[model samples]
Target: MTADLDQGSRTPLVSVLIPAFNHEGFVERCLDSVLEDPYPAKEIVIIDDGSTDHTAERIAQWVAAHGSEIPVEFVRRENRGIAATLNELAARSHGEFLRIGASDDYLLPGGLQAQVGYLLSHRNKGAVIGDSIVIDGEGNRLHDSGMCDLHGADKRLYDSSDGIRRAVIGHWAIGGPVTLLRKSVLETVARWTEGLRIDDWDMFLRLAARDAIGFIDVTVCAYRLHGANFSKTRHTATRIVNLTESREVAMSRVCLFDEPYRTLLRAQAQFIAAKIAFLQRRHTRVALHLATYASLLLLSKLRLHRTAHVHAEGA
Candidate 1:
């Protein structure tokens, strides 16, 4: 669908997409956070993925209360997984930019302004990601996110063509909720990869492969950590396995220029596999994966050191 921008207006429209699945307790706060934002041109789209809780009712109540203030659309569908819900939302969205909101996470004030401004200024960038604060289930701030703590006020524009590939190969560098993506860039990549537990991660990698991700140093959102979170659930082993496999599949799709980059990605995947095998108490598999992990790590280090030495000699 086309974005709803007035003929006379130059301000780009943004679509805030929320896929709700059973987050009854915190959904209102999440919705309120976005609604309270001062962005002049924006819309909220909520899709209730067969929530068994009162999430649907809460969303309905929210719409009734604030529907007139902002354009809001609500839909209820069977329990399609996260990837499918996101794809459907993308199809219905009418925004030049898209913010994927989590039902349990809250956007901080000025989040849209910060991200949208960056994207507008850097037309070549496909997405802009800000930092986030990690909060507890009760909405109490826990700490700065890993990205914030690691970067510590460095606001650098990354050419994801190489930077993002290296970052993801080493670790998960982008915060999902704090990102605002150009709709056209997402369309070029065809959106989220379906049926993977870490489809968001996959999407990030694919989009980065196309070389279009930016970073903003400001904290633009709060990511709530709760027991119900998929990463914290009792099925940790299964989730870990899915994560490893997803990384493997995603890495296979990208063609890295250097063999070392490919090896690092393979090592990271095996590291996750080793963790899962250890968790499941599969001794034989764990031993094999651990050996592979160590060897790969050594090789990666050696390669990096050699590259550095060559650069130093050139300097």
Candidate 2:
């Protein structure tokens, strides 16, 4: 066990990584929340993902005005999307801990400080995620509380194969710019997947497989569920495509090869597919749930055969 140190000495150097797209309207509010964090050594890193609006201009102005008082760094990159932007920010950050915040989302007051305190107190943990308030586009709080995974609540730090298996099987370790992760764990795992839409889920499963994760019961962040959000604008099919692809990437690394694990994943994938189908109004496809589960059972019976066939077919 790692020895706990003094609060002054043990205050983990936290870098608040804010990846901004076309969030000109709410960027200031987001930054304000970060600035309000009571943590003394917090550093704010904002990466503008090629915003076509005045986002860059606004950040520049804020920097000029209060840059000296706050430890903030601003970078502008070509519109490479959120995954690439986050990876770039992680690459350049020097903090011992990283709390990724979306420009559309803001850390509730005391959010950063509280998370840092928890993570430092429990040294073996790799990440700490908490509930978040769901708000409308105008920052009006729609819901005071968020979701959690009852399965993961008992574990102080998640490691080992079984722990990872439970996490991957549709356990709701709610993520979306509402969690704090250790920079060292991220460095070891590398950056986010560039081609995936739900990169947070992928990253979480991978990290939890290797280390411990803590859950804070209180909501410490705000998740903006606006109409203009990426998930809302994109077609359901496109989102599902990304989700399916990302799930494959994660499963491949962890349990895609094992029989029981692969069955579990296929079942969960089918469940997600059904949910997306329902959301897309494809009622016919929603009935595919039973078929998907049946197919999984049949495939599991011939697991080795199917695995060989897939590999041989080069699919």
lDDT against true structure, model 2? 0.72
Query: What RMSD does each model have against the real structure?
Result: 5.0, 7.3
Compared with the true structure, the alpha-carbon lDDT of candidate 1 equals: 0.77
Assess every candidate by TM-score. Answer: 0.84, 0.78
Query: Which candidate number has the best lDDT?
Result: 1
- Identify the leading candidate in terms of TM-score: 1
Write model 2 residue lDDT over 63-119, tens digit each, in one string: 787788788899987898878888888887879889989888888877776777778
Distance from true location, Cα of 101 in model 2, Å: 0.8
Flag regions of model 2 displaced more than 4 Å: 1-9, 148-168, 230-234, 254-263, 275-315
Give each model's whole-structure lDDT: 0.77, 0.72
On residues 96-134, what C-alpha lDDT tens digit does candidate 1 reach at each position?
999989999988887888788878777787987777888
